[model samples]
Target: MTDPCGACGARGCEELFHGLLALDHSRAEPWGPLHGVSVSCFLLQHPARLPADGGAAARGLLRAYLDGGLPAVDRLIGRARAANSHRVTGRSAPGGAVPPGREAPRGGFAVTVEEVAQDGTFPAAGFPDRVRAWAAATLEVWGPVSP
Candidate 1:
């Protein structure tokens, strides 16, 4: 789907800091060389206190996420398959089947974003930090999943 924010799908930390954040992101990108899989982490933010005109919209963010976000995510996860054909067929190596929940993210998982950077006022706080940590972990193939 096309991102309303032009490319990033959502805006940047500035928007997040101002509490004007909203996004429809899918996969930030998959990592790990092992039994690799795709994971999509969607982050949606409404005004912390809600604006006068946005109370209804803000109040319904979770519902929207549940009804729209989660279903879309599930569809994404369902449609998600191992990118490498060899891996899907186990032609790459020997491995047992995954139990469950070990696959792609189910419905919606929770992410806690504290303060990271800042908008010269509030701390960017956990948002940047978490994303950075995730990016690093991805590059290093953190946890190295077994097939």
Candidate 2:
């Protein structure tokens, strides 16, 4: 029940989406950290969800990565923090600090950026390449993809 291209994993497609991929609420990565975030905006404005709630979730997610161990590989915190900052406040968090009350589950902290610019562009420079490297490492563990 692996992916047809062998990129996702040995698990079934349904399993990957429905059961797994919860982004580890525990933040204790006994296995490892995720490769990279899939850059896309989700509609959290539905009746069941609200923007404020979504903001909280964003901070929580950021906490996981900032405190997680998988980042020991490449530490893509600059871009990750920026992404989190913009998500939480619609403004930049200069230090990439996870918002108050949302502490990272792990003891480690994110690699802080010297400064954050308000140029309106989301990710910092070289983010896409970092994403690729993360993906490459992930795919290597999952197995090769087909042409």
RMSD of each: 16.3, 17.4
Clashing pairs in 2: none
**Residue-level lDDT tens digits of model 2 in 2-118:** 433132222242333222234323333421133223110011111122243423333333333334533532354555565776446564322222235542222111110101111
Estimate the lDDT of model 1: 0.28
lDDT top scorer: 2
Candidate 1, superposed: residue stretches over 4 Å from native:
1-48, 70-111, 115-147
113-132: candidate 1 lDDT, tens digit per residue: 22222332223334334443
TM-score winner among the candidates? Answer: 2
Clashes of each: 9, 0
